[model samples]
Target: MKILKLEKGKLDLFASVVQQFGEVHAPTEHEGKFSFKRLNSWSEARLDYNRTVLPPRKYFLPPRETLFKYREATGYVPATEDLEKRVVLFGVHACDIHALNILDEVFGKGYLDPYYLTRRKNITIIGIDCTPDEHCFCRSMRADFAETGFDLFLKDIGDHYLTFVGTARGDDMVIATGPLFSEVTHSDIVEYKRRSSQKCDTFKLDLEIRDLPEIFELEYQADIWEELGEKCLSCGNCSMVCPTCYCYDVADEVKLGSHDGDRVRLWDSCLFATHALVAGGENFRKTRSSRIKFRFYHKQRGFVAEYGRPSCVGCGRCIEACPVGINIVGVINRLRGVEHASTD
Candidate 1:
């Protein structure tokens, strides 16, 4: 990995220089909360943001994207992003980067999703190390403070920030930018690991993720799901704000007078009553309890079985977004307790 340093008070310069390549996106104030937005000026970017309202996944898999456009007389023409316009996602947190890696497995697997693939091909990610957030549990999930998924990884040192270039694209950017960085000595690497290790305190939540999948298995019949369902409003805020939740529904829309129209895919939540209903009118997960259980299992259990890791990066967006304040960490802890009880 090529290492570089951005001197003190020049943090904004990172974004300014990256902008020269193409569009720059960083955490910026939107209304009242922080969101990843297009940056005209590097100063508009906020690096110390606790968390973004929506994860950076929107840059790859958008909420509402048009796949193709058509006319009644003509067949259809597929739409694609301008691959020439490069986008640099600056200030991405590690958990969000981990979420992107999980999405890569989902979208970039056997059946490549052209829409997500096109975006992935065009954009570059610059991830910032999380100092820690009160609600974040990234440490428990082992979403490293630094990751390989980033083109460049930045760690905030008091005077100068240390940057690691993980890919050829990242190395080229460092070379083109002409940012002066001293060669990283072995001692500096050791110090970086020490400081980053201290950042684990930020994720103070207690979650033994190694035992998560097995705990979930034992708690399938536990009464905690029913208890949570009562408090849950089924508002779908949890799924809506989730970084890795990729479930969607496809539908065709047509003008009132014409039978011709286009097919569209929109975000759908499992919490919805009809999410599992069949044409014959039999719904597999009929009750709110079952749906709630499914969501928890999908993230904590089923996904691990399928993907070899827990789907949650433990960003705790669901805890913050939930109207009833159903904390996922709390749910997992309760399940762990249930498992301990069964073993007794």
Candidate 2:
């Protein structure tokens, strides 16, 4: 990896230069919340934002997408629209980047998904460091800093961004900018380390994930599930906002009069009432308690068995999105028998 620095004043110019690579999308403020959207100009990019409403995962695995178009004559044709569109996702946080890496393991392995892999290849990720909010427990989830899964990563150090180039594409971006980036000095490294230490102290949320899978298994039938299910609305908001949640439902939509139709893949949540429904109206998880428990178990325990890590990145999107204020950190602490688990 190549290390460089970009003056704070040149950030706008750098943003402009990167547009040559692809359509630049960055975090932008809307009212009080933030989201990753196409930036009309560098001024629209909110690099200082804490967290976006949705993670950068949407750029790869969209909320809904057309899988294939079926017709009587041509049979089934793969949907190729926007599959090769080049996109640059800027100001991505470390946890979100880690989430994408986890998704790579899911969609990029076993039954490979061409649509997701194609988008992952075409899109460039530029990660940025963030101040951990009260809800953020990414540090506990081992996602506070990304070791890979990004083109470029920027760390704030006073007047300049300590940039780390992670790939050839990221190096190309640095090269295209001419003298905008400079060699990192000894003082720059010192500042980065000092700020990194300072950032660690600022995190208000902490979780111990070691042996969490075993703990979850032991508490499979704990009363906490029933308590959470009562409060949970079964709205599937958590899964929708989660960066690593990859559950999807596919359906063939036939035209009203013709045989021509399209197969669509839409995001699905295990928390939904119909998620476990099968033929003859037999639902494996009929109760809300079971549905919600399945979600926690799959992410914390089942995923660990398969992927060697929990699917939850601890980005705190689920914490903020839940209307009833169901906090993941609190839930985990309660399961561990911690007295007065931190909810805020």
Candidate 3:
């Protein structure tokens, strides 16, 4: 992998150069939290953030989007090709990046999801190494840092970032920017590996991912779920904040007097009572306990069964976002019979 460094006062220039290729997006402060937003200046991008309120996955799979547009007289017509603009999603955390890869497997497998694919194809991913925060559990999920799927990867080395080239497209971007990076050496690679390894140990949460699915399977009917349901408000915050929760509902919205309207897809949460309800009014998961259990099992068990890996990256945003202080780690820990699972 090639290495590059942005000289002092050249980060904005670096961003500008990348912008010429496509719009540059990165984490920026919004309210009290960080968010992935369009970058107009280098200051707009904050690489030192622990996590964003929402994952960067929204860039590829929007929270809500139109699958297709149609007129009554013309019948169904394919959506316009308005997604040709390329994008540089900068400063994506490794956990979220890994989550995106999982999504790729889901959406790109079998019959391709044209909606997600079109947006994914026009974008380049640039990942930034993050120092784990108190809530981070990426190490537990083994996605603390990425080894693949990123065009460019950056690691902070005091005065400048040590950029790791991961793809030919990434190499071209670094070269085109010109003279920003020092040539990568054998020693630098060794140092980068050493530092990254050291950072992994910083995470307080550690678990054997190999045992996760089995643990979940064994705890499927466990009584801990009922206890969790008691504390859960069923507010749906956990699923909404999750990077891998891709459940959605599609509906057609029509104007008052016209048959012509728009077909839209909006985010849905399994925590909602009607999520699994059928036309005949049979609800598969009727109770809060069942819904909560289904949501967790879907991530830790069902998704692993379907995709060969758990959908959760252990980013821990759900733990932070929950108003009732629901910690998924605690729930998992309690299921595993860990002694110290309880946390207020």
Candidate 4:
């Protein structure tokens, strides 16, 4: 509940102070696209970025991570990240925050993925509000706002920013650098509310959120997948840009003529034809249509059964990344219409 005002002028100084905690990773533009990268100074960070090409999850769950390294004679050693090291992730959006929470639940619930969870404990998240574009649909997925799960949430209030403290780590940072912040003014409160409330109107997604799960359920047998299969190139660009897609494939990389090697976990996708293939060449989701259907169903329906909610935060990165313009909202809406026809 701790909220402090950071004057627009002192933002760089504040970022400099925060950088003492760890390396600051923030949005930076290259070739007219935004992506998160390690910053040398506070000035290099872009808090006003529209969206990052890849979500900050790459810091936690890397695209390629070594699970363990082994030797021919020796057993094996875990090749996890440096758990003691800290990194300050700055300028994360609301949908990405929800995506992180989903990963926390997926990895922390039962198995307690030591590698991911340990690194998670060492990192700090600093979320910032953004101006949604036509592709943003986090509002429909109820991920447009986040009050918890992050260390600090930043809101732009015209002249200054309101930093809402969500965790003890965030509060501690503020308390340690007490001189950087000032008492919140009455004007600040009014402006923050005005901006946050009006942000909803900026999103362009017009999907029916509640009925989407049922539509996906009843339309499991729908022929819409055929259309998607035809449109989809199976390049896996959608899953790569997605903030919540966690499918991975494990491989053992061996040295030439030696038994010593490293077991690595690489990002995987259901769109790949061989994702469901086994040693004996048994492919369950063999058809392109079936793979396309499984991806949508897994995100919208199967995930609900396991997590009590759909996994999609609806940031619409997939929509923007899809080469053939296979939009998630359009897909869901099509299923809704097809399901209605089936019942009738």
Candidate 5:
């Protein structure tokens, strides 16, 4: 929990120093949007990006990954490709880091996913403070600031960046840069608090999360599901872009005319028609309405029952990614009987 300061001019030098630890990946502009990719240089890192098309979850639980390789002689050898690779994810937003913490709970408990856990250990997260946009409701979801689940976190405080060391590795990172970082001053603390208050006033979206699970349960039979189903393309764009959506499908890719095969897992969505299909072709959620309802219920209600919090981090990726302009904040307000949700 050590707080320090780095001059804005020295940020590029700090970024270069962290490269010795691992491959530095940061938000980079691509086709008018931003994505976390390997930075060719410090200049490519877009620290002020609003949001990425895909969250950093792709780094830990990849879109598709080989689980194991099978053969006649040696049975089911665990796939080790890229599991040991060290990566440094830089300039991550607070909500995305919170989403990773939620995923850690899901994958680290009950059944341990070595693939994900291994990558999680190898990857270093460097979180950065962000200004809330029109679509962002992370403050409502209690994810506007992260207390854990990051190695280093940076908050802009005028000419210097207030850096927080969250873990041992983060301490090592600070130590690695000889004189780049300096002790925080009283004025620096004042500047941080002033900006924090300013950021709070800028949120354009808000939602009441208290008693939300109960509200979702009461509205389970409401007409909104059908309305959303009609508009939803079942494209799975929301889940794909979501930071905490962890649904996955596993299948064995068998080699032609041989027993050799590779078992792989790919991202899946509850919205998909085949998601609920079973052995006898009996789908539990056959209708689009039921599928859509299940998606919301599981995140808002079911997850609360298990994890004490909704899985939705309120990063607004779902709101931004929905092609039909389905805004989650609007839906929640409508469900609560609010005539018009305030996005001001």
Candidate 6:
């Protein structure tokens, strides 16, 4: 990996050079939290902010999209929205980047999802290393560090930002930034490693990943599901905030008394009562307890069985967004019979 160095004060200038390539989408304040938005100025984006309210996955797989447009007289037509320019998704956290990689595996496997792939192709991900907050547990998931997926990865080391060129896109970006970046020196390498070590020690949350498979399998009928289900409001906030939740439903949305319409796909949450309902009034996951178990098992067990890794990156946005204080780490800890699991 090639390394480059830029002083902290010159960050905006570096972003300006990147802006020449494409529109820059970076973290900015929405209300009380941060989110990715098209920036009018590089300074508007917050490199030091906590995790965004929603993951950056939205850029690749939007909340809603029209699969195809239909007209009674004309039949069916594909409807692919044109995003005019390639995008630079700047300052994405490591966990969000990891989540995006997980999505690539899901969508790019056999029958490639052209809709998501096109958007993914257009984005040049520039990841920024983050110091974990109390709510973050990415370390436990082995998602705190990323080796691929990002075009450029930045880690703060005192007055300078140490950057890693992960791909040709990253090399191009660095070249575009030009004289602003200098070659990394021995001292810079030393400082970068020192800072990275310090950053790893900052996370407070931990999970029992060793026994996760056995715990998940054995907990198929565990009493914890009942307790969690009762507390679950079915608000769907957890799924919405999650970086890796890709569940969705599709349908034709036609105008009243008109045949012209669009076949749209919308984000769907298993937490919804009617999510699993089908024709003949049959519902697979009708009970709240069953739904709760399904959601947890899918992330911890089912995903592992398929992907060789858990769907959860331990970003902990679910824990922060939950109105009832239900967290996956706490659940895993409790299942593993950790002494202070509940209190944690």
Every candidate's lDDT: 0.80, 0.92, 0.82, 0.85, 0.93, 0.87
Q: Write the per-residue lDDT of candidate 3 for residues 18-78, one digit (tens) a residue.
A: 8866889898997769998887677878887888888877777778877777788997876
Model 4, range 12-120, lDDT digits (tens) per residue?
8777788877788899988878999999777778888888999988988889989999997888988855656789998999999999999988998988888888878
lDDT of 5 at 305: 98
Clashes of each: 0, 0, 3, 0, 0, 0
TM-score of 6: 0.96
lDDT of 2 by residue, 269-342 (tens): 99999998999999999999899899999999999999999999989999999988888889988998775445
Tens digit of lDDT per residue, candidate 5, span 18-102? 9988999999998889999999989999999999999999999999999999998888799998999999999999999999999
Worst lDDT run of 10 residues, candidate 6, spans: 335-344
lDDT of 5 at 296: 90
Best-performing candidate as measured by lDDT: 5
Clashing pairs in 6: none
Query: All candidates: CA RMSD in angstroms?
Result: 3.2, 0.9, 1.9, 3.1, 1.0, 1.4
Screening candidate 5 with a backbone cut-off below 3 angstroms (N, C-alpha, C), the clashing residue pairs are none
Better of 1 and 3 by lDDT: 3
lDDT (tens digit, per residue) of candidate 6 on 10-36: 888888889866789999986778989
**Clashes by residue pair, model 3:** 4-181, 5-180, 5-181
Which runs of model 4 end up more than 4 angstroms from their true locations?
Answer: 338-344
Ranking by lDDT: 5, 2, 6, 4, 3, 1
Regions more than 4 Å wrong, model 1: 81-85, 185-187, 338-344
The TM-score that candidate 5 achieves is 0.98
Candidate 4 — worst ten consecutive residues by lDDT sum? 335-344
Evaluated against the true structure, the overall lDDT of model 5 is 0.93
- After superposing candidate 3 on the true structure, give the runs of residues whose Cα lies further than 4 Å from its correct spot: 4-9, 341-344
lDDT of 2: 0.92
